[model samples]
Structure formats: structure tokens, C-alpha cells
Target chain A: MQAKQIDYAKEKRKSTLGWAVAILLACFWLVLTLTPFVFMVLNSFRKQFDMLQQGVFHMPDPWYFNNYVEVVTHGFFGYFFRSVLVVAVSLVLMLIIASFAAYPLARMKFRFCGLIYAGIVAMMSVPMHVTLIPIFKLTTDMGIYDSLKSLVGPYVAFALPMSVFILTAFMKTIPKEIEESAEIDGCGRFRNFFMIILPLSKSGLSTLAIYNGVAMWNEFAFANTFLQTPSHKTLPLALNQFKGEHALDIPIILSVLTLSVLPMIILFVIFQDKLVKGMMAGAVKG
Target chain B: MASKTENKSSLAKVRGKRVAVAATVFLLPTFLLIAVYFIYPVIDTFVISTYKWNGISATRTFIGLQNWVNLVKDKNFWDAFKHNVVIMVFSILLQIPIGMLLATFLDAGGRKFNIFKIIWFLPYLMSSVAIAFLFTYALATNGGIFSSLASLIQGKKVTVDLLGRSPHALFAVIGVMAWQYTPFYMVYFIAGYGNIDTTIYEAAIIDGATRGQYVRQIAIPLLGPIFKTACTMSLIGSLKYFDLIWNLTQGGPVNSTELMATYMYKLSFQQFNMGYGSCVAAGMFILITVIALLFQKAFVVKEDY
Candidate 1:
């Protein structure tokens, strides 16, 4: 009976110490994570004089919004729209191609299936940046240089291995009985893939879309290299322009940076679960 | 009967042919894109690296192995590579450990700590370019947070040139990288920890295990494979880090923060030495591929704990 009585006082004491330590660590990391963003937002409202004379910790007297107005008037929306277009087009192309290729490798019996899968997996280890010079030359020779076409082709190509890998892994988990039943209904291979397999793999496709969308949206290296025209430049390149033109104007630069950053943070907030799941799925499956 | 057998066999052959046709039809587009954009570029880069050519001109001068030899002796290349190595080491040291610690706390701390998990993960969601701009301003010596903090601590006006000084510039870059990327591993580890059976933790607790003891003894041992994967991911990511460094420093202060990617860009695009830049690209390819394969062989192959 005495043993059955738990030591509640002792347990409470132990847990209180644990809770204290955990809360302390969590608060420390939270502040560290949010501090820069807070500073950026705060500085975005102040004028150049206030930023220079007062300091980083200064509160804006009038909460000036002119920095954002300047950023918008400087043609930031074009870059934003161009980025959206590139990401959307690249995702559609990547998904269709990757799904088509993935369906056969996952379900069908082919002699070369293993070799093809291995090749795609091995391709992941090859850094695409290593082929920068050649890609630049090749695109120029193809007369697609300094255009969005250059970004689309390579973006879709490099994203294929991972996309195909994830889709194939997801497709493999789908039961074969569903397909066999469809086949027994006089459905051809292509019809069965579109009618049966595609609908069932919504999770995988969405995951790929988000994963590839985020990646393509932030792609700077290829875009920076291929795009030379001012109008053709993406958001990242346009934002980086401020470093040279408005180096001293911290408020304007911060406003531009905030504009580019908010969409991603909002997307992530809306689809946090899907994004996390997609990333984990990619890493684990790979 | 003979006619029936022949028709049956012919039907089987036709089905097999259709399957082949379908596979080819499905794979053709992806393969063509990969060939034109990925495979061809790699081969062309290797071929071009052996010769001397400016990017634009029609004339190409073939000088065998000269670019390769020059790349091996290039001080800037070595400096860039060493910086990559430093970033890699620092990332593995700080990012993984901090991620693991935070994951452990969130897992063990129960639902009350769940909100902090999301808050800490905010950085990982934004683009590296945005993150770079934010930190670049925050760490700016002129009226920046770091300078303000330094002044506050010193009881006088002081400025900390975190990204403008040698050696410190690379460390500052690494710190920003960790600040942005550690949440990735944290989320990753949280998922991994969620996969662990709670009964094991219960068993440990029943055996009178402390929280620290449970993490060290129970958690780490079970999370070995995940840990290895995280290390590989961090290593490979660090090796090719470009976007943040490009916006942050552009390999400034006498090439202190020069990474392989930034250096390669400077050589090819800015300097217009396509051949030498291709050589650097080739070197990067070799290093990335070798390190990845070697790391896999060393750590990932052993599945059994």
C-alpha cells in the first residue's frame, strides 16, 4: 500500500526544473531566430537619417511608409510576376514529365527499370553548378540565351531526378489490385495511368509541386547567369540590384527585401504541414 | 488448334510491344530534357576545360591540360576551397548539434513547447537571398544591431565588423547559414523522433532514467541513421553554398569568404575565362561527387545499430 502511493512532491519538483530549463532554451532560440527579421521590419519604416543618427534600436517617430512606395514604384511587381510565371511553368512541366516517367518505372515490368532508377539516383550527387560554363555556352549557341526559356529548360531538367524519385516512391506504395481491376475493365495503359493512377497520387504530386515550386522560385544562379536584360531578370536578381544602387538607403533596401520575403513566409504558414511532410518524404526516400 | 495457338502467341507478342512503346513514350520527354540540359553540359564542360577559349568568340584554341594545371596552382581557388571546408566543418559542428538539442527539448518538453518549434522554424521557410539581406543589414557596422550591442557592452560607441574582417567574415557567413538552416534539421529530427516508439521512453522512465540520460542513451542511439543522413545533407549543402554568400559578401575583404560556387561564377561570368572556370567547375563536380559517395559508403551503408 505504501509502495502504491506515488511520490507526487518529488516528481513535481523534478519536472519544474525540467520545465524551467526547456523554457529558457526555447525562449533563447526564439529570440535569436526572430531578431533579424524584427530589425529589418523596424528599419524599413525609418528614414535614412533616423537609421544613421538614432540607431538600429530606434522607434520610428512617424512610421514612414515611403520606402515601400519607392520599392513598388521601382518596378518590383514585374520581377514578382516573372518569378511566379517561371515557377508555375516549371512546375507544370516537371510534374507532367516526372509523373509520366515515374508511372512506368513504378508499376510496369521493364528490363531496364533498375538501371534507369539507379542512373537517376546517381545523378542527384552530381552538382549541377559544375556544368555552369557548359550550360551557358550551350544556351547561347542554341540562341535561347538571356531569355526565360533558358531558365525553364534547365530548371525542369535538374528538378527531374528528385521529383521522379519522390513520385516513384509514392507510386510504388499504391496497390497493384487497383490497376489490375482497371486493366480488366478494358482500359488501355495510358487511360489507366491518367484515370486511375493520377487521381490516387494527389499527395505526392502536390508535394512535388510545393518542393519544386519553392526551389525554382528561389533559383538565382541559373537566372543570374542566363538573364542579362533588365526586364527579364527575376525577383532575386532585381532585389540584389538594390545592394549596388541604394547601398546607403537601408530603409528602401529593407522594404524591398521584406516584399520578396513575405510571400514565401505566408505560403509556408498556409502549407506548413505539407511542406514539412514533403521535405521529410524527399530526404527519407532519397 | 494450331491456328488458335498461333493467334494466342501473336496476341502476347503484341501486348509486349505495346508495353515497350508506352514506356518509351512516357520517358522520352524527361530524357530529352536531361540530355540537352544536364548530361550534355557536363560533358561539354569537361571538353571545354581542356582548351582555351573566351565564351563568345567562334575561334577555339586547344591547349591540353593547361587549365587544369593552372587551376591546381591557383591561390584564389585554394582559398575558396578552404573556405568551403571551413563552412562545412562549422555547419556540421553547430547546425546539427543545435538542431538535435532543440528537437530533443521539443520532444521531451511536451505540448507546451510546441509553439516554439514553429517559431524557430520561420527562418528556414524564407529564401536564402532574403535571409542574407536581413543579416547583412543587421550586422552592418554602421548603425547596425551588432554594432549597437557591442557599444552597449563596451559602455562606449563601438562597431563590430563581422562580415568586413578576415577569418571573421567566413565565420559570420557560417553563422548566418546555421541560423537559417538549422531549423531544417530540427524539423527533420522531430519527424525522426516521432517515429520512435514511445514505449521505449516509457520503459526508460520506468527504469528511473533522467531526461538527459534518456536523450543521450536512448534517443541518440536510435536516431543514428537519421543523424548520418542529416550530416550528409549539411555537408553537401555547405559545399555548394552560393546564394547567401553572394548577396552577403561577394567573397569580399580579400577573398576571405570565397566559396567554390562564387569563385567559379567570378571566373566564368565576370572574368570571361570560360576554360579556367570550366576547370573549377570540374573540380567542384569531382569534390562533391567524391565526398558524397565516400560519406555514404562510410556512414549510410551500416544500417544496423
Candidate 2:
């Protein structure tokens, strides 16, 4: 009876401490995480002079909504559409291609499979920046310089390694019995993979599709460098131009940053679970 | 694991080959794209690195490894390398361990793990530009919260030029990198920790082993492969870290925080030296690949933990 009483006291103490510490840590994280958004949100309501002259700690005195209106007038919607165009097309192509590529590597017992696998892994390690010049030259040479075609091809190339790696690993987890049975049942190898293996690998494909889609959407470097014209530009590059023109305007800057991240924030808030699960599946590599 | 998964008869195996052929045929689009876009550019990067051309000058002068030879004596190249070494050390020293600790905290959070996990890993999923912008506000020396805290705690006006100094700037950037990525790494380690055998841990406790001993002896040894994978990724990541620093400071204030990748960017885009830029890119590519490959070979447990 004495031992039981002591155990109860200990449990109560643990509970109190856990709640207290967890709340404290969570608060600290929340503040740090929200600082940028807070600053952006606050500045979006301030006038230009009130921003740089006064400290960032200054409250949004006399809150104004003019900057956000200005952003819409500056062609943010076009930028948004172009971003969607790039992300959607690139992802669909990557998925179809990666599915086909993963099949041969995972299922077919081809000669020199080890060599091919290692070669692909090496290709993965080679930085895309190394070929920036050649690619730019080639894109211009092929006369697809500022078009969507230029974006699609290289994006597929760079993202292929990881997608293939994930799909291949996911493929390995699938048991051989189903494939063997399907073949015995007179279904062709192609049909076996398409009907049986493909269904099983939905998690991997979904993971790749979402992550790659988000990345292609957020891409700024290649988009800015390769596609120079305003009409061909994506969202991030468009916002970056806002930065260049309005180097000192805090409200405009804040609005642009918000405009850039708003879509991702919305998607994440909704589909956060699927994203994490997919990330884990792709990253674990175990 | 199945014996019957093997083909029963040679006649049946021939049919499998036909199916395999169809699958391979379907894979042609991907293979052809990879060859043209990926495989070609890399080979071309090497060839271009040996030439002296101003991108669109229409004349490619054969320089024959002059770029590599020049890079050998380049002070900026060495500086970038040194900076990356500092980044790699700081990232491993701070981020990896913090990630491990956070993973433990998240694991021990009981019913709150799901909520805390989402909150923590939120930054990882955000794009580099977004995070970099946020961190710039948070870490900015002037009126930044971090500086404000420093002043409040130390009871004085603390003015740290976080983006303008040498050692301080590098550490500040590294600090942000660590803070931003700890959660991503935390989840991976958490997954690794979940796979640890609870039965062994229980037995260890029953045998009078302390929690420290159990973790050190059992957990670490068991987690060897995952730990190695994490380290390999961080090492490569630190070396190739471009976007975060690029967005925050753009390798500015006299190249104090310049990395190989960022420096390569500067050379190619800002300086317009196609030759020098490719050289740096090639050098970084080789360095990262070699280190990662060597680490994998050294520490990867081929079969199982």
C-alpha cells in the first residue's frame, strides 16, 4: 500500500513536469518559427518610411492594405499560372517515366545490373550547376530557350535519380510471390508489374509526385537564369524582380514573400500528414 | 523468401523474358531522356571545362586542363573549401546531435508526438528561400529578436554584425542551418529509434545497465547504418549548401561565408567565367562523391544491424 502511494505521487509529478516542459518548448519553437511570418505580416500593413526609420519591433501603426492591392496589379496571377504549368507538366512526365524506368531496374535480372545501378547513383551525385552553362547554350542552340520545353526536360533529368531510387527501394519491398503467380497465371511480365506491382507502389509514387511537384513549383535558380523574359517567368522569379525594383519598400517586399509562400502554406496545412508519411518513405532508405 | 517464386519450367521462363522485353521497351522514353539531358550535359561539362569560351561567343578555345591547373592556385577555391569544412564540422557537431536529442524528446512526448512531430518538421518541408527569408529576419543583427535576446540577457546593447563578420557570420549561418534542419533529421532518427528492439533494451535494464549504457552499447551499435547515412547526407549537404546561404547573404561581405557551390555560382553567373565555374563545380562534385562513397563503404552494414 505504501509502494502504491509512492508510485502515484511519482506519476503525478512526472505528468506535471511533462506538461510544463512541453508547453515551454513548444512556445519557444512557435515564436521562432513564426518570427518571419510575423515580421512579414506586420510589414505588409506599414508604410515605407515607418518601416526602415522605425525598428522592425515597431507595431503596424496605421495599418494599410495598399501594398497587397498593388501586388495583384503587378501580374502575380500570371506568375502563379506559369508556376502551376511548370510543376504540373514536369511531375506528370516524371511519374510516367520513373515508373517505366524503375520496372526494368527492379524486376528484370539484366546483366551488369550492379554496374548500371552504381552508374545511376554516380549520376545522382553530379551537381546540376556544373552543366548550367552547357544547358543554357544547348537550350538556346535548340531554339527552345525561353519556352516551357526547356524547363520540362532538365527538371526531369535532375529529379530522376531520387525518384528512381525511391521507386526502386519501394519495389524491393514488394514480395516476388505475386509477380511469379501473375506470370504463372499467364499474365505477361509487363501486365504483372502494371496490375500488381504498380498498385503496391502507390505510396512511393505519391511521395515522389508531391515532393517533386512542390520543388518544381518553388524553383527559382534555373527559372530565373534560363527563362529571362517576364512572360515566361515563374512565381519565385517574378517575386525576385519585385525585390530588385523595390529594394527598400518593406510593404511590397513583405507582400511578395507572402504571395510566394501562400500556396505551399495552404497545401501543407491541409495535406501535412500525407506529406510527412511520403517524406519518410522516400528518405528512410532502410 | 519464397521457393516457388522461382520459375517452375524453362518454357515458363521464356514467357517471362518476353514480358521483361515489353517492360524494357516501356522504359525507353525515360532512358533516352536521361541520356540526352543528364548523361550528355555531364560529359559536356567536362569537355567545356577544358575550353575557354564566353558562353555564347561561338568559339570554343581548347585550353586542355588549364582551368583545373588555374583552380589549383586559386585562393577563392581554397577559401570556399575552408568555409565548407567549417560548415561540415558545425553542422555535424550541432545539428546532428540536436536532431538526435529532439528525436528522443519527440519519442518520449507520448500522446503529443503527432502534433509535435508536425510542428517540428514544418521548417524542413518549406523551401530554402522561404526559410532563408525567415531566418534573415530572426538572425539579422540590427533589430533582430536573436540580437534583442542577447542584449536583454547580457544587460547591454548587443550589436552583432551577423551577416558582415568572418567567424561570427559563418557561425551565425551555421546556427541557422542547424536550427532549420534539426527537425528533418529528428524525424529520420526517430524512425531509426523506433526500429530498435525494445526487448533487448528491457533485458539490459533488468541486467542493471543504466539508460546511458543501453543507449551507448545497444542503441548506437544497432543504429550504425542509419547514423552513417545521416552523417553522409549532412556532410554532402554542408558541402553543397547553396540556397540557404545564397538567399540570406549571397556569399557576401568579402566571401567569408562562401561555399564551393555558391562560389561556383558566383564564378559562372556573376563573374561570367564559364571555365573557372565548371572547374569549381567539377572539383566540388568529385570531393562530395568521394567522401560520401568512402563513408558508405566504411560504415554501412551490408546485411543487417
Candidate 3:
């Protein structure tokens, strides 16, 4: 009985130790993730002199809120709005086109369904830069170059393959009975897709939207190459100019970076579960 | 009854035509769009790589295999390829393992760990440019946090030129890339671990298996497919990596941080050497294809269950 009691105590101690170690490790990663953002936000409120005098870790003396005001007043908001518009338009179009394509491929029996799906999955493997030069030339040749509108077509096209593949994978899991019941009620193919499949695929569609939105919003290569004008620039390109434009105004630059990064962070917090689910579904299963 | 069968067969034929029509209507727009914009551009990249031409000016000189020949001999191209290989190595080494470890911890962490999962994933949500900028400031020579920390530790003022210096530039880029992407793998592996049957864990414990043995012997084996998938993703992404390097270093002070994508961009856009740029891109495409095909053949789990 005494030995049994000792063993029970030993087991409890081991588990407690394990718990403590896990918490410590978790906290370490938490600090690592949150520190940069905290540093960015905190340092954004400190002036260059203050930062230079008292290291980056120090709190701001007076907390200069004007840094943020300056960003908005100096046309950073235009870049912000431009990014929003571009991502919004691209997301909407990608959902529609990819869904339309995916519906037929997933639901209906077609001769080339396998071929088309394979082509899309293959397309996903081809990096954006491979086609960058050609698409740059193609857009320029067509005289649609150097405009925000120029970004829309390519963004949608690039977003399609993955979106379609994810949605198709999702739609495949959906029972055929749902569509069959709709068909029995005298609904045509297009009508059934519109009223039934489209509604049913909301989770999948939103998942694709989150994935594409995050990507297109952060997409620097195409935006940087295509939209050259300052007014036409997206948030990323504008942030890039922080190096040249602001020189070494560290706080101001941080403020601008904060501005650019804030929206996505907010969106992420709001749609955290959906974003996680979407990314997992899109990536792993794909 | 024979007449009724004939009528039903005609009706079925009409439904088949309608299905065909609907499929075409559904498939046509995305198909046409991808064909024109996506497909043609890839094919055109191959054709353009064969000639010597500026990005503009219709006067094109056909160099045949000359550009391709130059690519084989190009030092910068090879250097960039080497950098890509390094990135792939580090990503597999650092990113996947760390991600998997965190995922395992978070899986066992329970509801309290949910908040930590969200916090950890915050980096993956932000843009590469923003993340790069944040890190650049943190690592900058003057008044940057990294330098300040080093100065404090060494008892003297010191500045590390992370993005500017050649020796440190590539590693800095890799570090940042790993930092940004590790969370993704964490989330991915979490979903993977969640799929494993919990009864197996209970069984193992009942059989007197230690925690280490349970995770190592059983969990790791079960996660084989996910591990392969993550590795392939890391490999392909590393090979084609550009944006972070471009924004951070622009392949930097003597091309230390150059990768295939950045090199291709520099040649095409910066130097106006569209033909050579196309060649580099084609090389990247071929490399990526070969790697992807090899991974698919070798590591992809054969059984669905």
C-alpha cells in the first residue's frame, strides 16, 4: 500500500512537470510571435531622436500619435483603399468563376473532367514568376499596363486553379442526393446549381475567398510590377517606398507598416476559424 | 411498354444534351480565361527564352540555343539556384520540424492553447512586405532592435548589416521566410493530428507506452502523408521564392540573396533582358516540375485510408 501510494504520487509529479514544460514552450513561441508586432506598434509612437537616444525597447517619452495621422494625411490611405478595392474585386470574381468551373467538374459527368482538374492542379505547381515576364508583356502589349485594372485579370486567373481545386474537392464530398432531389423538383441544371450547390458550398466558397483575399491583398510581385504610379500603388508597394521615401524615419516607417498590416490582422482575428479551416482544406487536401 | 421505353430513351437523350450544354456554359469562361492568360503565357515563356530581344522594340535577334547556353555558364544563375537549394534545406530542417513540434504541443494543450494558436498564426496573416519591413527595422544597423541587443550584450555599440551584407543576407532572408511560414505548417499539422484516431492513443497508454513512444512510434507514422505534403510544399515554394527576397534585398549587394524568381525579374525588368529572363524562368519551371514529379512518385501515400 505504501509503494502504491508512492507510485501514484510519482505519476502525478511527472504529469505536472510535463504540463509546466509544455506551458513554458508555448509561452516562448507566443512571445516570439507577439514581440515584433508589439515592438512595431510601440516604436511607431517614438520619434527617431527618442529611439536613437534610448534603445528600441524603451517606451516613447511623449507618445507621438501624429505618426499615424501623418500616414493617413500623406496618401497612405489611398494605397490602403486601393489594396482593399483590388482584393475585393479579385475575390468576388475568383469565387464566381472558380465555382462555376468547379461545379460542372465536380457534379456533372464530363469526358474531360479529369483532364481539366489535372491541368488546374498542374497549374498550381507553376510559380507566378514563370509566367511573369510573358504576362507582363501580354498586358503591356494589350495596352492595359500601369493600371489597377490591369491587376484584376491576372489575379483572378492566378486565384482560379487553387480555388477551383479546393471547391471541387469540397463539392465531391457533398452527396449527389441533394442535387438529385433538386432535379426531381423540375429544376434545370443551371437553376439547381444556383439554388442548391452554390448555397451548399458556402463554407467552401468562403474558404476560397479568405485564401485568395489574403494572397491577393499581400501579393507584391504583380502589384509592384504592374502598378508603378504612387497613387495607383497597393499597400505593399507603398510600404516598399518607406525605405526610399521616408529615408530612416524609423517611427514613421513603423507607423506606415502598422497601417498596412493592421487590416489583415483585424480580418484574421475576425475570421480566425474560417481562415484556419480554409487554409487547411485548401492546402492539405489539395 | 416498348413505345414507353422508346419515349424514355429519347427523353434521356434530351437530358444528355442539356447536361453537355450546361457543362460547356459552366466550363467555358474559366477555361478560356486560363487558356488565354495562364496557359499561353507559360508556352510563350519557352518561345521567348530562345531569342535575344529587349522587352520592347520589334527588332528581335534569334539566338537559337545561345541564351540557354549562357544560362548553363552563368555564375549568377547558379548562385541563385544554390540559394534556392539552401532555402529548401532550411525550410525542411527548421520550418517543418518546428511547426510539427508546435502542432503536437498545441494538440495536447487543450482549450487554453487556442489563444496561443491564434497569436502564433498572426504572422502568416500579414503580408510579406509588412513582415519584411518589420524585420528590417528590427535588424537594421542604426537604432534597430537586433543591433541594440548585440551592442548591449557585447558591451559596445555594434550593428549587423543583415540585408546589405553578402554573408548574412541569404540566411537572414531564410530566417524571415521560416518565421513567416512556420505557423502555416503548425496549423496544417494541427489539422493532421486532429485526424488521428484518439483511441489509438488510449490503446497505447493502456499498453504501458510512454508519452515519447506514443508520439514517436505511432503519431509520427500516422503523420507520414502530411509530412510528405508539407515537405513538397516547402521545396517547391523555396525554389520559386521571390517576393520576400525582392522586397528585402532585391537579391542584394552582389547577388548574395538571389533566387531563381528574383534573378529572372532582375534580368527581365531591371536590365531589359527579356530573353535571358525567359530562359531563367523556363529553367525554374523545369526544376520545379522535376522536383514535384519526384516527390509525387516517391513520398505520396498510396492508400486513401
Candidate 4:
């Protein structure tokens, strides 16, 4: 009995040591992760020249707010709103079209169902860079270059493959009897989709929305390529615009970075659980 | 009886036709958009690669395989590709293992560690462009975080030229990429661990296994498929990485930090070398597809566990 007790004590000590190490490493990483953010947030409150005078870690002397005020007044919201508009329109269209495609691919029997589904899924690995030049040409040729409308098509197209993939997988889980009963009541495929299948796929659609919504919001390559006019630019390009204007003013640029990242951080905080769950849904399936 | 059978057959044909029409109507928009944005563009990229016209010009000359030949021999293009490979290797190496460690820590600690999860995930919330700009200032030579810390320790001001140097720039970029993406893999593995049946853990404990032993033996092995998926994602992500690098360095300071995407961007957009840029982009696409396929074929197996 005494020997057994000693073994128990030994095991407890070993685990405590493990826990200590784990906690130390976790704290180290925590510091590393927060340092840059601390730098960004802290320095944003300083005067432009004060950043150079004071240490990076030092607290702001007067806690200036003018940078934010200046940024907001200088069309920051225009970029933010344009981003919101583009992401909203693109996300809705992507979800609807993806669901439409996913429905038949998931539930119906068509001649090219397997082949078409495979084809769409295969496009998941095709990098967006290959299409960059041609899409640029297409945009300019269509006379929609430098406009928000040019972004919509590429956004929806790029998001479709993965959304369709996930939604199809999600729809496959819906019991067939639900759709079969609806069919027996003389409902056609269109009505069945609008009333039955679409309603049941709410969780899936929301997951896709959160997933694709983030991508569309932060999209840079296509936005950088297609939009040249300052007003048409999105949040991703806002930093470059601000940097171009305030070439030497580090605090103003930092404020712009902080402002551009603020909305996402707010959304993340408010919808933390849903957002994590949504991302997990994509990760597991993807 | 024959008349009744014919009537039923005709009705069945009408139903089939209606189903076909519904399918067509449902699938048309997705296919149309994809055709315009994805399929046609890829084909057009290859076709444009054979021409000598700038992206804006109305006139074009068919240069045929000359662009392809130049790309094959181009030192800068190959150097960029090598950089991509380096980043891919390091990303998979650093991000996955570190992320797994963080996830394992959270999993072992359970609900009490939720705060760590939330804090660790904050980096991912910010867009790459924002992070790039943030780090550009954070890692600057003068009045930067590192220099401040160094000055405090060494009793003198010390500047750290991370983004401006040649060899150090790529590694700095890699480190930043890790900082940005590690949280993603952490959450991914947390989900993987969550998917594991609790009964399995109970079973392991009943067999006198320690928590450490159980994780090391069963949990990690069970995560093989998820691990493979994560590596594949990192590989492809590193190969086509553009946004952060573009905003951070623009593949600069003597082209030390160039990747395929950045190189292609410079050529096509900055320099207006449309034909050659098309070739490079096409080359990158082919390389990524082939590498991803080869990775899947090599590592992805039909595992029962």
C-alpha cells in the first residue's frame, strides 16, 4: 500500500511538471502573439513624430485621437462601405448559386451528375493567379474595369467550388424521406428546393456565409488588379492608399491598419462561437 | 391494357423531361460564372502566353513558344520558384507542429484554457494586408519593437533591418507567415481532437494509460489524415501566396523574397510584360497542380483508423 501511494505521488508530480512546462510555453506564445498588436494599437495613439522620439513599448504621452479622426474624415468609411457592399452582394449570390448547384448534385439524378460534380470539385485546387491576367482582360474588355461590378463575378466564381462542395456534403445528410414526402404532395423540384431543401440547409448556408464572407471581405489580389480608382477600392487596398498619402507618418498609417482590422475583430468578438464553428465546418470538410 | 400502358409511358417521359429542365435551370448560373471566371481564363492565359502584345494593346504578335523558352531559362523565375519551395517547406514544418502543440495544450487543459484559444485566434481575424502593414512598422529598423527591446538590453540603440536585407527578408517573411497562420492550424487540430470519441479516451485510461501517453499514442496517430490535409493546405497556400508579400515587400531588396505569384504580378501588372507573365502564371498553375496531386497520391491512403 505504501509503495502504491508513492507511485501515485510520483505520477502526480510528473504531471504537475508537464503542466508547468505547457503553461510556460503557452504564456511565451501569448506574449509573442500580442506584441505586434500591442505595438500597432499603442503606436496608433501617438503623434506622427512622437513614435520616433519615444520607445515602441512606451505608453502614449497625451493619447492623441486625431489620427483616427483624420482617417475617418478622409473617406475611410467609403472604403469600408464599399467592401461591405461588395462582400454582401457577392456572398448572397455565391450562396444561392452554390446551393442551387449543390441541390441537384446532392439529391437529383441527372446524366452528367457525377462528371459535373467531379469537375467542379477539381477546380478547388486551381490557383487564382492563373486566371488573373485573363480576368483582367475580360474586365477591361467588358468595360467594367475599375468598378465594383467586376469584382462580383470573380468573387462568386472563386467561392462557388468550395461552397458547393461543403453544401453538397451537408445536404447529403438530410434524410431522403423529407424530400420524398414533399414530392408525394405534388411539389415540383423548384418548389421542393425553395420550400423544403433550402430551409433544411440553413445551418450549411450560414456556415458557407461565414466562411466565404471572410474571404470576400479580405480579398486583395483581384481587388488590387481590378480596382484602380480610389473610391472603388475595398478595405484591403485602404492601407496602400493611406500609405501612399502618409508616406512618412507612421502613426497615421498604423491608425489606418487598426481601423481596417477593427471591423473584423469586432465581428469576431461578437460572433466568436458561431465563427469558430463555421470555420471548423469548412476545415473538417475541406 | 395496351392503351393504358402507352399512357403511363408517355407520362413518365414528361416527368423525366421536367426533371431535366429543372436540373438545367438550377445548374446554369454556376456553370456560366465558372466558365467566364475560371475555365475560359485558364485557357486564355495559355493562349495569351504565346503572344507578344502588352495587356492593353490592340495589336498582338504571335511569339509562339519563345515565351515558354525564356521562362524555362529565366534565372529570376527559377529563383522565385525556389523561394516558394523554401517557404512551403518551412510553413509545413513550423506551422503544423507548433499549431499541433498549441492545440494539444488546449485539449489537455480542457475548458479552463478557452481564453488561450480566443487570444491565439486573434491574429487570424486581421487580414493579411493589415498584418503586413502592422509588421512592416513593427519590424522596422528605427523605433521598432525589436530595436527598442535590444536597446533596453544592450544599453545602446540597435536597429534591426529585417525587411530590407537579402537573406533575412525571406526568413522574416516566413516567420510572419507562421505568426499569421499558426492559429488556423491550432483550431483545426482542436476540431480534430474534438471529433475523437470520448469513449476512446476513457478506454485508454481504463487500460492504465496516462493522459500524455494516450495523446502521444492514440490521439496523434488518429490525427494523421487531418495532419496530411493541413500540410497539403499549407503547401498550396505557400506556393500561391501573394497578398501579404505584396503588401509587405513587393518581393523586393534584390528579388530575394520573390515567389511565383509576386513575380508574375510584377511582370504582368507592374511591368506590363503580359505575354511573359502569362507564361509564368501558367507555369505556376501547372507546378501547383502537379505537386498537390503528387502529394495526395503519395501520402493520402485509405486508412481505416
A111 Cα displacement, candidate 1 (Å): 0.6
User: Could you tell me which residue pairs clash in candidate 3?
Assistant: none
Q: Which wins on TM-score, candidate 2 or candidate 3?
A: 3
DockQ, per model, reads: 0.49, 0.36, 0.51, 0.50
The local lDDT score (0 to 100) that residue A274 gets in candidate 4 is 68
lDDT (tens digit, per residue) of candidate 2 on A144-242: 988777898888877887788778878888898888888889987667877998899997888788778887887766775688888788876775677
Q: Which scores greater on lDDT, model 1 or model 2? A: 1
Point out the higher-scoring one by DockQ: 1 or 3.
Answer: 3
Location of the lowest summed lDDT over 10 successive residues in candidate 2 chain A: A1-10
Off by over 4 Å in 2: A1-30, A52-55, A184-186, B1-13, B16-20, B135-143, B147-159, B196-220, B297-305
TM-score of chain A of each: 0.93, 0.87, 0.92, 0.93
State TM-scores per candidate: 0.93, 0.87, 0.93, 0.95
> How well is each residue in B1-305 modelled by candidate 1, as lDDT tens digits?
12358778798677768887899899999789777877888888889899787888998899999999998899998889899988998999999999988988777655566578778888886788888888888898887788998898999999899998998988888889999989989988887777677777767767887667878899899888788878888899889989999888999989999999999888888898888888898988888878888888877557644
lDDT tens per residue, model 1, A3-53: 212432345467897768767878899999988888888889999778877
TM-score of chain A of 3: 0.92
Model 3 lDDT at residue A14: 60
**lDDT of all predictions:** 0.84, 0.74, 0.84, 0.89
What is the lDDT for A204 in model 3? 92
Instruction: Return the top candidate by TM-score.
Output: 4
Residue A270 CA error for candidate 2 (Å)? 2.9
Candidate 2's docking class is acceptable
